[model samples]
Target chain A: MSTTTLLLLLVLVGVLTYLYRYAMIGLFASRSLPAWLHALCRHIAPASFAALTASGLFVAGGEVVFAFDTPRPWAALAAVLVAWRTRNVLATIGAGMAALYLLKLLFPT
Target chain B: MVQIPTSAGGEFLAGCRDEAPLLLGVAPFGMIYGIAALAAGVPAWVAQLASAIVFAGAAQLVIVQMLAAGAGFIPIALTSGLLNLRHVLYSASMAEYVRHLPRRWRLLLAYVLTDEAYAVAVLRYQQRHAAAADHAEHTDSGTPAADATADLRHWYFLGAGFTLWAGWQLSTAAGLLFGATIPPEWELDFAVPLTFIALLTLLLRERAGQAAALVAGLGALAFAALPYKLGLVAAIVLGLAAGAWAVRRLGPVR
Candidate 1:
C-alpha cells in the first residue's frame, strides 16, 4: 500500500475506534444502562477474547491448520489445561511456551 | 467510600500497581507487533507511529499483516473496524463510571482503553463501586454516611490507561529499532495469543463464561476459512449470542 493509503487506513481506524469507544458512552451519558444491554455487553469480552485466542492458536498464513504436526494446537492445549488447573497467568504462559518448544522439538515441522 | 476522601494520586498509584503483571505480558507483545509490521513491509516510521495512532495491539497488527498481504485499503480498514468493535461494548460498560467526568477526560480515557486496561479497570470499578454501594445501603438504613462519593475513579483509570500507552510505545520502538537483531526462532508472534489465553482463563471463573469461551473458540476454528478474516467476526457474534442464550438459560452467573 502507498503511504497515502497507509495514512488513510490509520486515520480511518483511528476515527472509527474513537467512535466505537465513544458510541454508547456518548449515547447514554447520563442514562442508566438497560439490564438487557448490560447483560449482553458482559458476553462481548469473553466471546471476543476466545475468538482472538482461537485465531492466534489455530490459524497461520491466513489458513486454519490443526494437524498434529503443528505445535500451536498442542501447546494451546497445554496452556488451557494449566490455565484450567492453576488459573494463574504466569504459569499458563510459561507452560504454554514450554509445551510449544517441546512439541517443536518432537515434531520438527 | 471512606471516612476520608482518598486523593487522586493514591488511586493513580494503585492503578499503576495493578497493571504491573499485565505489563509483563504486554512488553513482549508490543515488540512482536513492531517486528511483525516491519517484516510485512510497512515503513518503519508508519509502523512505529501506528502503535501510537492505533494504540491497540491486536488491530494494529492485523492492519499491517493485511497490508502486507496486498489487501485493499477498504478491506483493511473494515477489518480493523470490525476487530475493534468489541471496544464499543467496553466503552459502554465503562460509560456509566466516567460519565460524570468531563468530555475531555472521557475522550482520553476512551482512546487509552484497551483489552488489558479494560480488564483491570472494570474489575476495580466493580469492586470499588460495590463497596460504595454497600456503604450507601447502610446509610440509607440510618447508619451515618461516610464520604460515599470520594472515589478517585478517573485518576485510577488514567493511571492504568497511561501506563499501557507508555509500555506499548516504548516496546514498539524497541522492536522497530532492534527487530532485525531478534532471532526468528523465538516465535514472539505467539505472545499475543498466549496473553489472550491468560486473560480468557481469568475471565472463565463462571460456568456461563466457560460456555461462551468454548463456543467462541470452536466457532472461530470452524469458520476460519472465511475471507478477510470475517470468521473472527463471526465467532465473536456467535459467541456473544450463544453466551447470552446460555446466560438466559442458566441465569446470570453473578
Candidate 2:
C-alpha cells in the first residue's frame, strides 16, 4: 500500500472504530436499557475477562493446545491457584511468570 | 444531583492505583505490538503515529501484519474495525456511568476506552455501587453513600486511561528500539492471562459470577477457531447469558 493509502486506511479505521465505541453510548444517553439486557450487562465483565484469560493461556499463536505439554496452561494453573489464594493481581502475575520461566528451563518447549 | 464528598484528586489516584496492577500486563502487549509493527517494516515514526491515532493494540498490530502481507487498504481498515466491534459493548455498559459528564468529557473518555481500562473501571463501579446499596438503609441518617461514587467513577476512568496511554506509548517505543532482543525468557505476554485470572479470582464473589466466567472461558476455547474474533464475542454473550440465568435461578444474593 502507498503511504497515502496507508494513512487513509488508518484514518478510516479510527473513525469507524470511534463510531463503534460511541454509537451505543449515544443510544444509551437518553434512555435506560431494559431489564434483561441490564441483567446480561451485569455479567459482561466476568465473562469477557474469562474468555480472554482462557484464550491467552490455551491459544499459542492462534492454535489451541489442549495437551498438558504446553507451558502456558501449566503456568496458568499456578496463577489460578495463587490468585485464588492471595487474590492479589501482582503476586499472581509474578508467580505465573516465574513459573513459566522455570517450566521453560526444565521442559525447554 | 447530590455531589459526592470525595476529592477528585483522591478518586483519580485511586483509579490509577486500581489500574496499576493491570499495567504489568499492558506494557508487554504494547511492546509486542511495537515489535510486530517494526517487523512488518512499518517505520518507527509511522508506527508511533499509528499508535497515537489508533491507540488500540490488537487492531494496530493487525494493521501491520495485514499490510506486511500485501493486503489491500480496504481489508486492513475493515479488519481493524471488526476487531473493535466489541468496544460497542463496553461503551453501552459504561454509558450509564459516564452519561452525566459533559459531552466533551464523554467524547474524550470514549476515545480512551480500551479493554483493560474498561475492565478495571467497571469493577470499580460494581464495588462502589454495592457499597452504596449496603448503606441505603442508613439513608435515614442522611448520609449520601452512593452519590460520591457517581463522580468518582469518571475520575477513576480518566486516571486509569491516562496511565494506560502513557504505558502503551513508552512500551511501544522500547519495542521499536529493542524488540528482537527483548529475550524470550521474559515471557511478558503471559501477563495478560495472569492479569485476567487474578482479576477473575478477586471479582468472583457469587455463584452467578462463577458461572459466567467458567462458561465464557470454556466457550472461548471451544470457539477459538471462529474468524474475525467472533469467538470472543460469542463467548462473552453466552457467558453473560449464563450469568443472567444463574442470577434469576438463584434469586439474586448480595
lDDT of 2 by residue, B62-154 (tens): 576555544566545544664566677788888877776678878888877888889988887777667666777667532343363445677
Residue A86 shift from truth in candidate 1, angstroms: 2.5
**Where is the poorest 10-residue window by lDDT in model 2 chain B?**
B141-150
lDDT of 1 by residue, B1-254 (tens): 32322788888877877777788888876776787777777788898878878888868866765565455676567557766777777787787677766678877788887888888888888887667678676566322123425657778888888888888899998888877776768765565567678778788777777777788888878987777666766777788778788888998776
Please estimate how well model 2 matches the true structure, expressed as its whole-model Cα lDDT: 0.73
Looking at candidate 1 chain B, the ten consecutive residues that score lowest on lDDT are B140-149
The CA lDDT at A71 in model 1 is 86
The clash tally of candidate 2 reads: 1
Show the lowest summed lDDT stretch of 10 residues, model 1 chain A: A25-34
Which candidate leads the pack in TM-score? Answer: 1
TM-score for candidate 1, residues paired by index = 0.73
Cα deviation of B103, candidate 1, in Å: 3.4
